[model samples]
Target: MPRISHPRSSSTPLHEGGELALIERIRRRAGGGASTALRLGIGDDCAILRPRAGEDLLVTTDFSLEGRHFRRDWHSPQSIGHRTLARGLSDLAAMGARPMAAFLSLALPPAVARDAGWLEGFLDGLLDLAKQHGVPLAGGDTSESPSEQVLADIILLGSAPRGRALRRSGARVGDLIYCTGTLGGATAEFAQVQDGRGGKTQTASSMNPHLFPQPRLAAGQALLRRKLATACIDTSDGISTDLAHLCEASGVNAEIDAASLPLHPLAQQLTQEAAMAAALHGGEDYELLFTARAATKMPRKLGGVPLTCIGRVVAKKRRAPQVTLIAADGSRSALAAQGWEHLR
Candidate 1:
């Protein structure tokens, strides 16, 4: 029987079709290798791995889908490609691992595949990021799709010293919560870029934060090396939501001083209260949120990135798993978890 060209329509809600089948087909094409070290590749019950002695493996995966995660019309193919890889690499950096290799799986609309330059540019962007971090692309698959959306999934593998991986569950009471770089600037930029009101200056600076978010690899690694962080997580899900994750994992609550948040200059200029709200709730910042002992005198900056003491982890109270924001006037309010939620 001839293979069906496309998956069932989205409205049909069928189990099969579109990108899912394409991924399976690609896995079947890459036959298994005979080496024991070739632990996990395509088509497996679970990815098996044999870690080298004295090393702990770090693994992370991220997916980018057009419209849902990004828009092809607004972003160039190169930017999309770069952001996809950066998102996954940032996860590895959060663990303070040295990047080793990456694997990408792409689902391309027929239109995009036909444009040779478009694909080349996208690959160029991905390759450029890989070279900058010394992580090479090991393998991936490509396929055609009926939808105009372009979807990319990246898997990154790295390694760290044995038994030294940083985690979000390690935070303790009285630990100071800190974050790198400025906040809310990316969301403000997104608003302007989407509205077309972002002039050259806003377009250049504001939107760039959202478009090309830098992973805090160096700072994360340094924190790990210095044993300064008891807990860590990448701030892809806004400061409020991400901090909440750490608190939840550590069975603690958090209090963030609203006045203490380090707002990006662009965010201050382009947005005011609402923008600050978005910065607290908006996702995709890709910065690092971490905790250290209250006595730890963290530098004002890490790897030239400004470090802000935003709040502290506290014992779980009756209303546990809550994040509270303290105003400058000493008034206390609930910090809403308004970050990205797919189902919402």
Candidate 2:
């Protein structure tokens, strides 16, 4: 008889029931409330909400895991803490909502919890970013974990005028697509840090892009105020994948001009190919990609942020559901829809 092998039981408390299974369990535990504003509760980019006759609300949540989302060796406790808050805040920005407050939940291992000063520094970093955006830290929970990893969950709540918040499914065919700020710089810097090349000698610009990402709140708000964007989504999962998401949600396809993509100076300096691959496939850019009417006259800059017109939405005519890239020579090629899919 052949010997049989059995899978080892998971020691990590968080992973004991598996991540997806845990989320499903929590979903079942949650009870419904009598809130007219809570249009969507969970299972979407952000929770859709309409407050009162004159108000709308947007709520979003994001989580950061030490080993999977970040590493202590590569990032300071401050950077990690700031990013944990920024991620959820960026989602609020994407919906063109004015941020109000945030709730944070931290799960710390015994090793990390033993350092009181480190914990203070982490909270300081989180508070600093929250204050800069005029977002208050409302409340949260802390728990000790058996693993050697630190995890944080941030929930943000923001409000907008009734029927004014942007959604991913509003894009129409022939709408011009635009992106705020250049891309790929963050991924390049992350690559350097992961390769052990990031040290005291690294340039400020290179480190800043990766360490600190600004959530384009003002720009998104302005876009909504002007009714310039028909559809909007933040580029946390890279331009290519996010565009695919917008197109998918809108029941359309997109054609991007490769030559028109905005390349950050750092991305250009670091890679001769302009890091277009990273810009297209790398995550964590936190920039906004929105679509507007083709004939719409958008300002060169919005709220002091530069906006670059890069592509347009097109009707899907029997083509495989994907975004197409048009080269400078007018040759068209299909772009992959792959990005940072958590399950993969």
TM-score of each candidate structure, all chains considered together: 0.82, 0.82
lDDT of each: 0.73, 0.74
Off by over 4 Å in 1: 1-52, 197-207, 342-344
**Residue ranges of candidate 2 with Cα displaced over 4 Å:** 1-53, 199-207, 342-344
Best by lDDT: 2
1-344: candidate 1 lDDT, tens digit per residue: 01222444434311234444544543443332233334555443334546568888898989998987777766666667678888998898788877766777786776666565676666666666666676656556555644777878898888888888789899988999999988886686677657654322211222477766777788888888888899999988888888888887888889998888888665787546876786698767778899999999899888668899999988888954478899899989888777874211
**How many clashing residue pairs, candidate 1?**
2
Alpha-carbon RMSD of each model? 6.4, 9.4
Q: Candidate 2: lDDT over CA atoms?
A: 0.74
